[model samples]
Target: MACMEFTPEHRGTVRLEAREYGRSVLGAPLLYYPCRSACRLLVFAAIHGEEPETTFLLSRCLRAFDTNFEHVAFVLCANPDGATLGTRGNANGVDLNRNFATSNWNPAHVQSRSILESARDTLLSPGKAPGSEPETQALVALIESLKPESVIAMHSPIGCIDAPARTPLVERLQGTLNLPWKPDIGYPTPGSFGTWCSEHRVECITLELPRLAPELLFERYGESFARFLAAQD
Candidate 1:
């Protein structure tokens, strides 16, 4: 594989193009940057609107490349409406992460902490049924279409690489990001994307970035992350 050069020009602007995979609850386009060849990995961010740092850091890494990746696809933001509204849940008030159509999908409300140290006081709906929200439905369809062997869902504040097994991809991420690997997030995530991927036999790794300002995260991990992504070929 050729070494990917991180051009300064693209760092200021995203030159790579994106295609629409679906629409959000607010009719905003749900976009993803497809790979040039068959996809082996699919990385997505910002399932929770409050975690915009996930999107920001991923975008910074992406802008380092001028062309499409050969085997890695990216979804910079999965819940646009929620991000727009600055709410953890989407416009429909559903936590998109808990809305996947997995066997453990629950119709009950899910509780999340306002901050890592705070109590789990914030309650968000997990949707009336499994995969009820449009964002969840579209993401499911997109994953099916891409058929990637692995998926990395980016989130933040609890800093660790969460996966069932320490596969090569997990090790690569652990090496590049310098985050500890945990088999679980220490809680039950019933209808989470990771669970969905487990049920479907696709490896899933959750990259929980450490709590930091957006610019700080980019400064710390952006370049290494871009190189890590470029090596996926």
Candidate 2:
């Protein structure tokens, strides 16, 4: 992505510092900006490098919100390296997703995203260890600093909402979106934003959108979110 294509504000906060990791070859610099509301939402996309649709969706919604909401968040693309290469790992071949110190952290495959695979080929490996990748470290630090009340980890093609399952907000999300609330689908990811949020006691949504309908994502997810927020009020 051309960093210049984005206006100054879209380029992320000018005061925001740039962090590096994993040779810093494959990814673009991560960015963060403040929201208009006291409450904030952390939107992550392209965790799986193959799922580029979510990134576009997130970008669209963010620019749209910049025009519409008058309030949004520091939309951060957690792994620019992976996103650029269209691979699950960073330039160093580490599956930084699995690098988190979550309970299910994998030791072997974590060092190599290519080693681990699932039915749908979602690589659930971390790097040699949690917080290994600079990308991951930057994300962890951002999450810790922001301590957002709500979060949305964007993933794709599932078209459903999944979380810790026990969160009452899941039901509220289910009712609003008419999507099922599911358990942490056995794909154990240690130190992942989702699991990390659980540890921090933050209510989050792992919103899985269909890779095909990139345009309608905000409409679909936002409609549900708007309804959910209204109910909370």
Candidate 3:
């Protein structure tokens, strides 16, 4: 694939249009930028609403091209309600990441730290049942439809390229973003999108961006990330 020529004008505006995949709990439309050819990779960001930088950085990367990719698809914001409300969870206060229907799906409430250095004092529901949230259900359906060989779930503040193995995709990302590759995030994540992907035999990579301001993240990785994605096409 040829390198995508960045349009400075498009930087100020979103050029690539999105198609609706599903709706959030608050009835907000869940949108994704579909590929122009058979999808080989699907990269989604903002599954956790509080980490809006994941969405921002991905959006900035998408703005580099006026059209969609030939093989790579994207979901700019997976949890719209949580993002709009600036909450970590959805309108139902359930952590969408923990709502996937995996065999290890737990009904117990999950605790998260207010900050990486803080204690795990904040609590969020894992949904009443597995895949209970509409966002999770819709995302699952979208994956089933696209049938991408690999899926990348974008998250923030952890700053690592996390996958079960350091495959070519992982190596490419590491070289592009200059982030360490970690086979695990050093914690068990039951019912996570990665876990769900593992169960369904889909390769899932968790790209955790370092703790930085959104603008800083874009400045640091925007062009390189866009180029990396373009290369994947």
Which one wins on lDDT?
3
lDDT of 2 by residue, 1-233 (tens): 10122344553423323233223434466665554445455666776675677777555434422222223344446667777877876776666656666776557554322322433434345676766777777777766776677777877666678886546656666776676667764555556667777777877788776545555665666444543433442
The Cα error of candidate 2 at residue 182, in Å, is 0.6
Q: What lDDT score is found at residue 176 in candidate 1?
A: 97
* Candidates by TM-score, descending order: 3, 1, 2
**TM-score of each predicted structure versus truth:** 0.97, 0.71, 0.98
- For 16-45, candidate 1 gives per-residue lDDT tens digits of 789999999999999999887888999999
**Which residues of candidate 1, in runs, are more than 4 Å off?**
1-3
User: Lowest summed lDDT over 10 consecutive residues: which window, candidate 3?
Assistant: 1-10
Question: In model 1, what lDDT does residue 133 have?
Answer: 95
RMSD of each: 1.1, 6.7, 1.0
- Could you tell me how far off, in angstroms, the CA of residue 103 lies in candidate 1 after the best superposition? 0.9
lDDT, residue 11, candidate 3: 78
Across 1-233, the per-residue lDDT of candidate 3 in tens digits comes to 52466676777766776899999998999999998888999999998999999999998888778787889899999999999999999999999999999999999998898899999999999999999999999999999999999999999999999999999999999999999999999987888999999999999999999999999999999999998999999
Model 3 Cα shift for residue 92 (angstroms): 0.4
